[model samples]
Target: METLMAVVIGVLFACAIYMMLRRSIVKLVIGLIILSNAANLLIFTVAGMTRGAPPLIPEGLYAPSGIVADPLPQALILTAIVISFGVLAFSVVLIHRAYEVVGTDDLDQMKDTDT
Candidate 1:
């Protein structure tokens, strides 16, 4: 499973990079989204997949009694998801405004809009 996930993550990263290299502004945004998802998957894959109890202590115990899921990686992934969503939303809005003003979505064409 881990090996499969690693391969999938590698493919996603490659696709994201390829999309990012395109000349279209829309493709750049798609690449950013793909890159963010790949990052989240990488974090998840590195954190180890285990079916365990929650990271909580029993009533009288100071620590977990058995194997417990690590909360740190989950927290990090959640935060990253929220942050990435906000960034992607902002990017989409920015791109829309740019399109409206510049009348084109091609980066090469946009270069001339400033003049």
Candidate 2:
């Protein structure tokens, strides 16, 4: 499962990089989204996958018994998701305004208007 997840993450990262290299503003935004998702997946995969109990410890126990899932990765992923959503929302709005002003979504064409 870990191997499969690693492969999927690699593919996502490659695709995101490829999209980011495109000349279209829309594709850049999409790439940012994919990259964020890949990052989240990486954190998840690196933290390891356990089918054991949750990170909760019994009242009488000082530590959790058996294999317990790490809570840090889940917390980090949740934070990343919220941050990514905000960034994506801002990027979309910025792109929309840029499109309205520049009248084009092509980065090459946008460069020409800078003068």
Candidate 3:
């Protein structure tokens, strides 16, 4: 499973980079979204794959006993998700506004207008 996830993450990262290299503003935003998702998956995969109960310590115990899933990765993934969402939203709004002002989504055209 971990190996599979690694492969998937690699593919996602490659795709994201390809999209980001495109000359379209919209594709750039899409690439950003994909990059964020790939990062999240990488974090998850590096944290190890385990199937067990939630990390809940019994009364009077300092740590969870026996086989228990790690909470840190889950927390990290959740935080990343929220942050990515915010970035995506902001990027989309910025792109829309840029499109309206520049009247084009092509990066080359947008660059020409800077003068």
Candidate 4:
């Protein structure tokens, strides 16, 4: 399972990098989302795969006879998702504004407008 996650992370990283290099704002935003998901997967897999229950335990702090997931990685993924969502939303608004003001999606032309 870890190996599978590693492969998924690698593929997501590659696609994210490729999209990040593109000239459009939408692709860049997608790249950012993919990068976040890759990071989340990497964090989860590297923490070890545990199956049984949620990190939250009502049976007390002790092991209590069940294998539970590591809470840290879960929290990390949640924070990452929240941050990525905010970033994605902001990017969408920014992209719309850019499109309205510049009339084009090309980064090269956006840069050339100053000169």
Q: Note the Cα lDDT for every prediction shown.
A: 0.95, 0.96, 0.94, 0.86
| lDDT of each residue in 49-92, candidate 4, tens digit only | 87757756465565545676678888888998999899889999
Give the per-residue lDDT digits (tens) of candidate 3, residues 9-111. 9999999999999999999999999999999999988999889898888999998899999889999999999999999999899999999999999999999
As for candidate 1, its clashing pairs are: none
Tell me which of candidates 2 and 4 scores higher on lDDT. 2
Candidate 1 lDDT by residue in tens digits, 1-115: 9999999999999999999999999999999999999999999999999979999888988889889999999999999999999999999999999999999999999997764
Select the stronger candidate by TM-score from 1 and 2: 1
How well does each candidate superpose onto the true structure, as a TM-score? 0.96, 0.96, 0.95, 0.87
Model 3 stretches astray by more than 4 angstroms: none
Per-residue lDDT, model 4, residue 23, is 93
RMSD of 1: 0.9
What order do you get sorting by TM-score, best first? 1, 2, 3, 4
Clashing pairs in 4: none
Q: In terms of lDDT, which candidate is stronger, 2 or 3?
A: 2
lDDT of 2: 0.96
Between 1 and 3, whose lDDT is larger? Answer: 1
Per-residue CA lDDT of model 2 for 1-115, tens digit only, reads 9999999999999999999999999999999999999999999999988777888989999999988888999999999999999999999999999999999999999989963
